[model samples]
Target chain A: HVTEAVHEYSIAHSTPLPEVVEQHRARSIDFANRVGMDPGMMVNTLQAQFMLFLAKLIGAKKVLEVGTFTGYSALAWAEAIKGQEGAKLVCCDIPGPHTEFAKATLLEAGFLNKLVTFFEGDGVETLQSLPVDQFDIIFLDANKDGYLPALKTILSRNLLSARGIVVADNALKQGLVADATDKNPHAANSNPGGVMGYEHIDEFNKFVRDNEQLEQVLLPAFDGLNIIRLKQ
Target chain B: HVTEAVHEYSIAHSTPLPEVVEQHRARSIDFANRVGMDPGMMVNTLQAQFMLFLAKLIGAKKVLEVGTFTGYSALAWAEAIKGQEGAKLVCCDIPGPHTEFAKATLLEAGFLNKLVTFFEGDGVETLQSLPVDQFDIIFLDANKDGYLPALKTILSRNLLSARGIVVADNALKQGLVADATDKNPHAANSNPGGVMGYEHIDEFNKFVRDNEQLEQVLLPAFDGLNIIRLKQ
Candidate 1:
């Protein structure tokens, strides 16, 4: 568990995200609020920073994101691979106002065509449609229930490279995946989404942990981040 | 903050460390207890897991560790880079029973000369005497006050590869670096080491943040792990 002071300090000391990415995040939150949607769908700033660090750490040139909520994370990924040769980011999200906004925002950020490819459709279908190539990084943050299915597709199709990593967000779902009882404050919240998604997330976690072909580390930081890789 | 249930659940779902490494960790704790040393000086299992993931993420071949307390972390590093060609782990620590214990342990683990090279002396001095070759990863976990100087030397001597990362453990020192007041329980602990190292860690954090040449993310997990790199 992290205290507010400690959290603030950690963020302050972390590398600042690009101004464009920050603007996109703020705009996404505003849009979500205006549309009566939970802005929590977007990755937080610290998570964004960590993802950027990860992308660069692996010298990621090919990235795939199963979810592209308002393109904030896509922009961060674009920033990470901007100058690299032949770097590409593929994002999939169901068609809607969110997808439209993401397209517009990323175009404005100069990443739409140059670096990112947006697919408006079901996540698994989109994964199936992609060319048979290995992605250095694959990020899963879409519908909770779709996580395990998407992962199965990714692995069966060999979309993840030999040395690549898969980063799954909300794997813990506010710790509800681990503890769905009344003790978890999130369980008593007005929104039952956390409790509802508990079964799906827990299933995904267990599947990843038990799958002999994969290895993962579930971090308690944030909503529980799962960094997974194929066993070497 | 994280609850105990969440923490335990997270670890349970994460990948397990190698049996040898786990045995070494347990032995290290027993040795520390017998010698009246704080076993906490060694990294926790979760941190070791994270480091292993990090090394594999970056495909690290050359690693430098400024601290070698009982060789627990060094052993983990050796495991991470084991099969890679020319993989090498260089460790620096003061001459003492700890170093001797570490040597014997690593030798028994079949990594002494095979993958690790141990140095005995002041951390900074040992770092200065090393060759000018770049290391893919450099870990700082020695004397708190020596962090800044060691970093400066590392940079000045071009010891870190272009895309390399420097992971500094205990960068937050039980949150005292952020809030060194009675409000922080660590401030009142019998071990003044946290309080004593407060300024140094704080200074190091600020220096890393302010340096235009370096970018860092200080994670709040596990007493604060700072992942730093040169600006692109």
Candidate 2:
């Protein structure tokens, strides 16, 4: 429950994102506009700042990102682990212009080979090939339907470290997951390609809640963020 | 902004709080009603769950709480560091019925003296007496006016560990700290007992934001929560 004024106030009070990451975010937005893609695909600046805070709070060294759109978020994560020895970020995304843009942007930011590696292929396949129990943080920001499968693979295969956390973006889909009815204005655009988008996210939310192995908190901020950790 | 349905949906999907903690929370509400105290002094269930997640995420071992209204939030921290070796939670509050209730409740929960210690004095004095660079997490929920002083003492005295964080509850004061005008309904109640509540909170927010030694993110959930860390 945030008003526009309060949201702006919060952002103004928060630590500003690094200038290089901000530059990448701007370029990503421009690229999305030029290519007629949804700019909302990228996390907002505040969300990025929150993720950075989380990464450093847990001292995350190895991070796995399911979607690396133009490397905006990868840049944020890179900033989080900038000076840590042996820190590495592995990003997986589909092969397309988005990957190309991400590679170039990250390279220009001087973190390409130094801190980040890209696996340009299917998300699930890339996750399957990674070493188990290595990633201290796994960020899920890909397709809605893939959220569940990716989480399942991560847990079943032990892809997350002993103290790792999995953060899933767009878990609520503009509150559609909670109420996808006519009463909600956003519900009108809740579905595309004849598939109910909220259903997939709702299923993911329910699965996370019911799974005895996981404990989660669904933050009702910035579309929705699910912070999950393996029960000790 | 969040609607009632979405807020409910979020709570339902989040990991449930422990049954003992829930019982404590219920008793806290009852105590507040019986004594004509505001139940809002205690944190809601969702906020407590978030704190638990944060504590575990950072593997907090030593916690310092500036407020312990009936020991509700302290119990949450205790659960977070349950089985860890040498874990301790120090709670400071003015001696009164609140302290007695907190002692009884925490003792009933098997945390009094075993895991939590009560200082029973002024918040600032209590903070000043804490060991330097020891506390992994410091919870600030005491008097609104004392927030800045308490934070200053914690910083100047190095009460927070190198990787530790300071969490301030009610940082926004029901959005009044951002907009304390007639346009906001909460503004009228913003001033009580010849003191302006929002101004104190706003001052604390600005001080935290302007301090070069600290980085913070203000989450617009549950009144408002400020997550802060020392600049490395």
Candidate 3:
């Protein structure tokens, strides 16, 4: 009953998103509509702000993003690292309308490949082929099914910098991951375009929970964000 | 319709709270019943975890707390600083049942009076009497109206370590702060309880938003938490 009001309360109280980010978000939303994709995939403004603050709070210099949808989140990360002359963000996403839109929006955000280097391939393959430089922050937002594999790959390959943080967006899929009964339409493949083909997101959620090398907490806000701190 | 589901999803996905913290939380709820007060003032486990990660992320060696309701949050901070033998947490709260409950819980957590030093009296006066020291983190969970004044005190006093963070619980005030309209029941005076006396929390939210020395984000989840990073 009071749920929506409570959610809106926090959003209204937050410092509004920067003009640059909001503009990029608008462009992404427009592009998503044109391409008939879910605009919800775009990083919400508060999430963008949180990620930006976190990156700066830790002095993150190198950022790796698995999903570059419209580049909203990457742009946010770039904003945080702007003062550093050499800070870089390596983004990986498949060649598609989403990334194409991301290219256009990144340009609009005044970063247009400046601090960002967009890879043109699947996240797993792109990450595997890259030179081994440690990443201070590694964000996972692509293909929900790949969360576990992507995380395992990130850790097993020593891609995270010392004291690095790994953030996974949409760790909870509309509460379906928590309670995937017949009542939860999101758990069904036919509902809402098989978002990530309705993979067992719960499994990925569990791996992060049980991993010995990681200490994690899921910020149960905004589609369920999983914030994991690498103990190593 | 999906709002509650989303919130629950995140909470469910989170790593469950340990027995020590849970025991404290349970005790607080029970104590709140005895005191005829709202139990929601206790920091939720997810928020607790986030605070712990943040403190450790900045390698916090000193923490300051403005409210010590049963000492739940202080314990959370202590858990984060477990290995840092010299780390200290200074807490200020009035002498009352809450502080008494906190003392008992702290002892029950196997950390009675360890790493934590409680100051009894008014928050403002208590803070004023303390020696000026840069804290890696300063948390506010006191009177609602105290948000701005407390923040001003913390900032003017330079009470934050370099890369320090200031966190205020209930920055959202049940969504009423965002829109103090008569139609919004939570915005009305006859609501659950005025944790901070509903002292225009939106204004406090706005001050944090507008302040230059502070870069802040109001997380709309979990009753609206505002996290501010001191730029200096």
Candidate 4:
């Protein structure tokens, strides 16, 4: 009965913390509205806070964020690494309205020195310019389509610390990833956007499974966050 | 088009590395068959590997496991903490056929002292016997109904390290969780067992939300694993 209860508890209340995050979406939403930018459907604040806490727990000093929409995620990370000696956050983003807002807010947060590097322009190019094995923690919130490329680039350049952990946003498209390949008779409508199309998260899940360089778990919080830790 | 390919690739690949243990699974399966067991569960293998890797990466020395089914999970933690002096594992279980097998294997693996201690009989009672602040990692794979109670006992007793990690398995229940709660009509039959009474996971998830002392992530891997790390 008790074992059954535990299983029941899990099924009944799966997204425990995310519900609170859903309630606390005001700050991010307001910030997005004022800056005339969308939050790019990324991680929620509570989720961001938890991640930053994880980064600090692991003693992360040098961090990399591929996208900088209003700098919320960047600020969360900066808060953790702020007072540490030689701590820094390297943010990559093309010049945009949100990037401008992010720059101002992060500066006001007094994290400018600790979270100041900006790789303006193409993320792939910017990632290439960085020295090898530099970042202790990397956040992949860039173009969803670029998730694999950016990851390959990071791996090839040896940008991640041997113990580095990377978190990718929106790895699952709602429940769209439930079906492995969706090749049934209704497969066409099942996958409206085709194999590599937009309205799907299967491709991403498969990529994570196929890659033999890292270990990852997909969390169903704030759309779907993939928590990946580099094995090497 | 290139972006689409990138997107598809992102889902198609990830950072998981080749596991050295996969090659041995068939052998393990044969051993299990000869010894009369299910070779454990495939999902549990993935969960065990992931948890062991994390524990090692975090420099965990003291660990606790609630279940000792065939000693597979215990072996995982042992492997991670093998070389470290003073590293230990505390396992709680009722005497079973797998118990003898576990003892022989662990002792043969040269973990006689390191792999010391197994509390037979009531697991909850055995857990209470551990000295406070003694564990850096705790794995919950015992009786399902005991999850919440075990969580309370471990946290209350302070057996967990200050910066410790707790991973609870089988929280997803083959997607049956939603049915018990009636959150989604589509997922109505998910929870055939009503033991999920009072929406336990929701209560747990919400507890994590308001509690700033811990950072948690619920991952959908091998039925579902909830990772809770103490915040500091």
Candidate 5:
């Protein structure tokens, strides 16, 4: 029944930063491990750092994260939005056993006051029912099959800002997208919701190409991330 | 002497649209048969289509083109903006023997009205002195050496709208950028322009990476095109 977080790697590896930023990232990972939550979905350190760097460069203040497993991915985005004027994150996820651990970690990291709203409900319904027109940036790391539907809902709601950037994680699926039409053995066979929507990365590529409003490029970072933007 | 622009290879056998677009692209290639100036620089028809499609999708109205060799690029952009509610293009290029021919072609194509404006002058100077700051999109295909300077000028002028996208052509340079530090064979002759100011494509890649306010991806289509947007 231990809930304490740990940092296995030394801070010596990272460049100078506010000690608090580095501490939170490590602590966030520890919380996930403590709860038996899989940290496997988190972006690799280099790619995470780069994404944070990009968010900082863009001065992102409002962020939307579609998945919150153990709070590792959420922390990466939250940290990037830090130091900006009035930054906040809206994290969406269905209620799970790990929610308490994630909430505790966010509080411990002093991010509660930063408006990290945690809504416990059906993620798709939550996203569709949300009342908003634009968000500064959005990150997707939830159910793989929900990407397109989530995107459609977000765009329809105008929940993405005019200059907003959208990042979709697990796009490469361990090189599954190299040939989009083929099936991936790694995809979970059990459909928890009675629906399977595993995406072939190539199909997503086609999705981007066919979607005139989005200009997308797939970066083979970590598991692969699709960086997209409003076409303007 | 009839100065007719002809592709010795029969047009029936070629992808004429791309050839037409490339004719708009600027290069010092001496055509074996040049009837009337260079019939605009051959624009990469596909690339032009890409940019134009993006422009329309974003509802871009004001566009500025840094180079108008033969006006093929200008025409492609114009074609995209033509049917829109109110879109216009301001093209900058020094007047030369080819300007007259380009003008005729644009007019014949029915793109000469208010949609296209030709500015005969040093493109860099024009870009620097332009009075406006809210361009929906900007295309850079001017002097190769001027690439960096033109980019700086564009960034300094703040001509790009928040949702604006800037596409720079000739980014790959036959893969010379694969080793950007090495001197390019094309620039070895000590041409004053120095291969459009960058010895290799790597320099441009570095430029894009170093800038904090923009996100750029190099696409391998028609030589190479760099698609960029403000970081946010």
Candidate 6:
């Protein structure tokens, strides 16, 4: 029940995507189609605007994105950081043709700088292996259930810089993350797994809310986004 | 249309509103109900978290709000500015019992001080009359159609500081701003006035996009928010 027409209109009213962004997004979609994978992993382009906006808001010089599915979001951060000298973006995803495809897209976008590092392994492993402990922003968009562990590791490792923020995508998991009942439209129409798929996001959301060092805002837009700013 | 249950669950996961915020919101709702006016003018509480998050992200010290409805948004801006020494928030709205109610809420929140000022007059006039030449942020939640004039006034007054932002609420106008067709759910079910109500927002959204002096992103979240960052 996304009400497709209204959503289409919302996207239309916002800033239209740049040619590079649109090209990269289309490349990812075509790759997903060929691989028989879910294109839903590619975030909506409207959300790309939100990320770009957030990056500027924080004056982020460095951004880390877990889940570099074809690099749509990675390119977004890169675009956001453009004109900032020595800015960097690190993306982590398992080594695969898809990962290589994303790299190619980044290259095509002309954002393939000396600083854009790709970790070709488990996102968590990459997270642990990063040489730097400070990132202005860490974006979690990998496996949904892995978020809790990632959160714990980020906190334990003290990976975020002062005033840094952590953004978790799909925190709503198609509204099923909130309304777990079978009667909900997303739950009834597609989520045959009941609430199992979104349990981790639910846990992560609560952890963000309950944590003393973090202040969280769960935005109910496009599958939900958790904007968690560290109080420390 | 908001799918109240899922939305409530989403809000439940976000940071819980403070007692003062909750009290003001409740009071506003009660007054709206009593008067048979739409309390829908009041923003959803979840957006309060976003506002607070943005305020901190920018380290905002001075905020200018063009619409001070029962003061929910004004109080939100006030709460966001807390702990910053000498931070100020100026609100503009027509004089009425609603504005009076908002004043009382600010008084109760203990945020009324030399820093907080209220302008009881037309929003644009107040904008032109402001003594300050700059602010960290300017928020527009006033009359929907007045946004163009308000934008002109803010820019002519040079009210926004460097790297400052302008957030206009209801930029989507319940999706009608995006889609005005009878096929759209909101337009068909609720809006009998065609797209007349949101013409200003529609124009403003386009103006933000087409204008070279600003870079804009229209976030299709809680009633839609237009984040306009001054390029100058």
Error of 4 at B142 (Å): 1.5
Using DockQ as the yardstick, the better of models 1 and 6 is 1
A147-202, model 1: which lDDT tens digit per residue? 88889999999999988988999888888776768888888662434433767888
Q: What is the TM-score of chain A alone in each candidate?
A: 0.94, 0.94, 0.89, 0.74, 0.79, 0.90
In angstroms, the error of model 3 at A121 is: 0.6
lDDT (tens digit, per residue) of candidate 6 on B85-166: 8799998889888888878778877776655788899888888777966788899988776788889888877888887898
**Candidates 5 and 6: which is better by lDDT?**
6
Q: If scored against the real structure, what TM-score would every candidate get?
A: 0.94, 0.95, 0.89, 0.71, 0.58, 0.92
Ranking by TM-score: 2, 1, 6, 3, 4, 5
lDDT of 3 at B225: 75
Question: In candidate 2, residue A130 scores what lDDT?
Answer: 72
Residue A182 in candidate 1, Cα distance off native in Å = 3.0
DockQ of model 4 vs. true complex: 0.23
lDDT for model 3, please: 0.76
For model 2, the stretches where C-alpha displacement exceeds 4 angstroms are: A131-133, A192-196, B130-133, B192-196
Worst lDDT run of 10 residues, candidate 2 chain A, spans A187-196
Question: Can you tell me the CAPRI class of model 2?
Answer: medium
Deviation from native of the Cα of residue B147 in model 2, angstroms = 0.4
Candidate lDDT values, in order: 0.87, 0.86, 0.76, 0.64, 0.62, 0.79
Residue A77, candidate 6: alpha-carbon lDDT: 88
True contacts kept of 6: 0.58
Model 1 Cα lDDT, one tens digit per residue, B147-206: 999999999999999989999999888987777678887777624344247788888899
> Which candidate, 5 or 6, would have the higher DockQ against the true structure?
6
By DockQ thresholds, what CAPRI class is model 5? incorrect
| lDDT by residue for model 3 (B104-153), tens | 76766666567777888888777767899988888888877666777778
Q: Model 2's A-chain: what TM-score?
A: 0.94
lDDT score for candidate 6 against the true structure? 0.79
Residue A83 deviation, candidate 1, in Å? 2.7
